[model samples]
Target: MKNIRNFCIIAHIDHGKSTLADRLLEYTKTIKITEGQMLDDMDLERERGITIKSHAIQMEYTYNGEKYILNLIDTPGHVDFSYEVSRSIAACEGALLVVDASQGVQAQTISNLYMALEHDLEIIPVMNKCDMDSAMPDEVEDEIIDLLGCKREDIIRASGKTGMGVEDILKAVVERIPCPTGDENAPLQALIFDSVFNSFRGIIAYFKVENGVIRTGDHVKFFNTGKEYDADEVGVLKMDMVPRKELRTGDVGYIISGIKSSREVKVGDTITHVDRPCAEAIAGFEEVKPMVFAGLYPIEADDYENLRASLEKLQLNDASLTFQPESSLALGFGFRCGFLGLLHMEIIQERLDREFDMSVITTVPNVSYMVYDKQGGVQEVHNPGGMPDPTLIDRIEEPYIDASIITTTDYIGPIMTLCLGKRGELVRQDYISGNRVELHYKMPLGEIVIDFYDKLKSISKGYASFDYHQAGFRPSKLVKLDILLNGESVDALSTLTHFDNAYDLGRKMCEKLKELIPRQQFEIAIQAAIGSKIIARETIKAVRKDVTAKCYGGDVSRKRKLLEKQKRGKKRMKQIGTVEVPQKAFLAVLKLD
Candidate 1:
């Protein structure tokens, strides 16, 4: 226990967290071969060039003739996956705060630093990417000192790409970071930081043994769910799962107990021996609050149950994902899943298809709203179709967020314009170190639901680092905008938006829908409406068949007769023809410029 060091890497996205992990693993001879971002083994993570999940691996290193067991959990740097970072932090005694030497002290960097401090985790600041020519080590060192209040020598100047200062980092972990402190003889108490489902082995839960010891074939139960299972296999995580006879206190390892049902295993749940359970559950683990809500409907209505099971298994892997059963008039049966942001939503949709074989349609994302009826009762609504009628709704309050953006001084004007265009109010600005400024804003969550982050990145030329936390809902002039096809409302495309931008948004949605929805045999009128009032409209002209092509040089009466016949046929078709809203049309709301 005294030789074990548990630590995690936390930083902004693309700050070389994975790269640094690669260097450490190689230096310790954990793996004979090396690959870029080897910790990010998922195909999606590789293709997207981002870490979507936290990966845990054990490495043995000899320092001053003393071998140490270093349990490292490399975490995703994106804000959407911050929950993963938080869970990783809870299971460790130390954290390596990786900040890019070129791009010093971004928003997520500060946010992750605060999270580590809140958990009382010892922080070892590592200034990564020092090999790059554009790297400003001195300036970034100052920024880290300002944020972490650490001395100059405390910061390790490392280059994940070139393996520079990699030795110092490991040395710091041994000398500075505290060893895990828990009673090995006490009742078994472990915190499950993460879990993954295996078809052959059932659910595999990775946990840190805080107290006591867990041995193979021991009966253990989860404190939260109260389900007991025999530890079929106990092991520590290396490049692969290395089976062990027992795992001691302050050790991080995986437990497989033949738990088939995903609901039986909960991430962040406490594990203890059934015979000698702890006095109470471990504290400091908080439930995640999803910021964005969207409906995910299976393409085939019959796949609803299968989709549910898939989501259950997926949820075991991703604890932050929340969903409940819901049905829509337009999209049939589905689940309204809550996510952290747009990128998180997209990743889940992709996973459903790639990992679970479930093809789904996602509704336009929105934030939950508080609808206060005339009777003074407040009801929360996540979907536009679930909203109460305007007559009964006395007022609506939408969720707001306190957003912090770290960018160079050059892009401040454009970033402000982008935020203000979305009705964001500037809170304050501070120059933490040099020309890099952190801008704070109070903005409606709905405004940034779709393309706000993408726009911020583009406007700042990828220099901006943005992170946000929810501020409680506030009263706003919001209205539900409904899209109608031939006067029939499509609930899947409905959205709740601020009243001031409703007209322009409605107009853009209509125009975009016209471009996406295919022209039927009869003319289709696409209209955007708000409570019986149409604010914007577009017409998809019918694919007309030229009935007069064969009437060349014919009498005027004959041509008129043919035209009249075609017109009557068209009229009949209009009455009976049903428009098929293509899948892209449902996604048009997200692309409205």
Candidate 2:
């Protein structure tokens, strides 16, 4: 077996984690023809520098004429996959922590570095973006030593974009990061970090060998679930693609364990020989949980089946994701989907929009709430639509989020002021990096439901970054304000809120909804209310001029098309007699500004 060096790259969002991986692939000939004629699958990865998923690749290089196999794992930088980050760190013995020299260290960087330390991995600090005009390598190195508590000589100055200092960085990996240590004679075992599906190849899993060697046609079993499968082929992820091959201990590789479905091979599951299984799997694996949830429904009700199939296919590769069919008394049918966080939710929405070509209306996300009934029975309610009747709800509790903000010292005042305005309680503030502070707060999830991040970025001029985790539920005065259109409660107009801001919140939401909803042939009454009391009301005046101007034979098709579109659009609108509430009205309420 070749001497293997297994490591992972971690950083905060937009810190050039994926860019560094691309540079490594190009330099190591994993993407070019100098080493081997192959093109890096840099289409999506290059366009979006964020590694939305965890992936690994292998390259062969001769350092001092001693050929070494470098197995590099690229991980997601967003806080949404904090759980996945833990698993990826566990799969490697060391990590190359990339920090933006221009921006310095971020909250997510500290968070991920702590996770790496918890796994007891050797951290090799690297300052990226050295090619930028504003980059400060010396300052970044000082911050790394001060904040990360690393030695002065441990940091590497490198720019992944210009191919500067990359060789030295790789050499440092070979010398400073120790080779994988495990019982090579032990039973074959590897931990699945991520997996995906192929049209002809069935399920493909990317894993890191923790012990022994795995060969093709070996009978293997998943340690946690006790599920067995025959190892169909061994492979490695190269150029953002999977190529089949044999892999050994200390090497990160792919195993198509004759498991036809990706659901069978889950992230963090250990693969071991069925006959000679390891005594125990490596520690630090944790279950992935969804943090944010929203209701997703097709603009057209007939696409429910297609929606279900799309969700099933999405889940095939993402076992941590959860979704279920849900229905509203007024909206008919929909699905409540769970996500790791806001970025995850955005990616899913973008995928659905780009891949499925479906028009979707997504409701505002809500964290699970606890309800204490008049009988003193506490029930967890994930969906606001499913919350018990307010009359029966003796006490309502809302979810609390532990939020951290990384920003320049100048914006600390505005950011913290905004946080306090949102009913956020200050926890602590620490200097994360030179001139950058980490503001920790416990805030109501409801406050951040809309454009809190956007406002933060705006105030900080896009310099601030935010990361948050659900702390738990806290008892609070909560109510579900149901918006009505012509005396009927619109199913999509429900918002879980505190009683204090119900009036103004409802007013602002209804105003935005009114603006979003297009004018109709008939007038629509948009009213926001608490129970039977109307707090805010707006009228969507009927169309004063909407008919086509020309109806000649040449313009007949165009005229008919316009008329047909209007009729179909009107049909999609929920009409209560003369009142017409367009579907976009429900959507606009979800969009704060």
Candidate 2 Cα lDDT to native: 0.78
Compare the candidates by TM-score and give the number of the best one: 1
- lDDT string for model 2 (1-593, tens) is 43678888999978877667777878787775342112223233345556666767788777998998888877878777676677678888889999999988877898898889888898899999899999988888888888777787778888877878789888988887888877678887788877777768777777888789887888889988788988887867666555455667787777775566545666788889988999888666877767678888887889998888777666666666788888876666989988877767777777676666766777767777889999979987778778887788889888889999988899998998899888999999987656888889999987886668778889899899888877888899887888876677776668788899788888897788778767766667788888778889998776744668656567568987888887766655535354445666665665655
Q: Model 1 segments beyond 4 Å from truth?
A: 552-554
lDDT values, one for every candidate: 0.92, 0.78
Which has the greatest lDDT?
1
Q: Write the per-residue lDDT of candidate 1 for residues 1-593, one digit (tens) a residue.
A: 89999999999999999989999999999986555788999899999889998999999999999999999999999989999999999999999999999888889998998999999999999999999999999999988888888999999999998999999999999998999999999999999999999989899999999999999999999999999989999999999999999999999999988899988888889999899899999899999999999999999999999999999988999999999999998889999999989999999989998998898998999999999999989999999999987889899999999999999999999999999999999999998777888999999999998999999999999999999999998999999999899999999998998889999989999999898888888889999999999999999998988888888795899889988998899899988888877888767678777
* Model 2 regions lying over 4 Å from their true place: 33-48, 240-245, 432-434, 519-522, 542-583
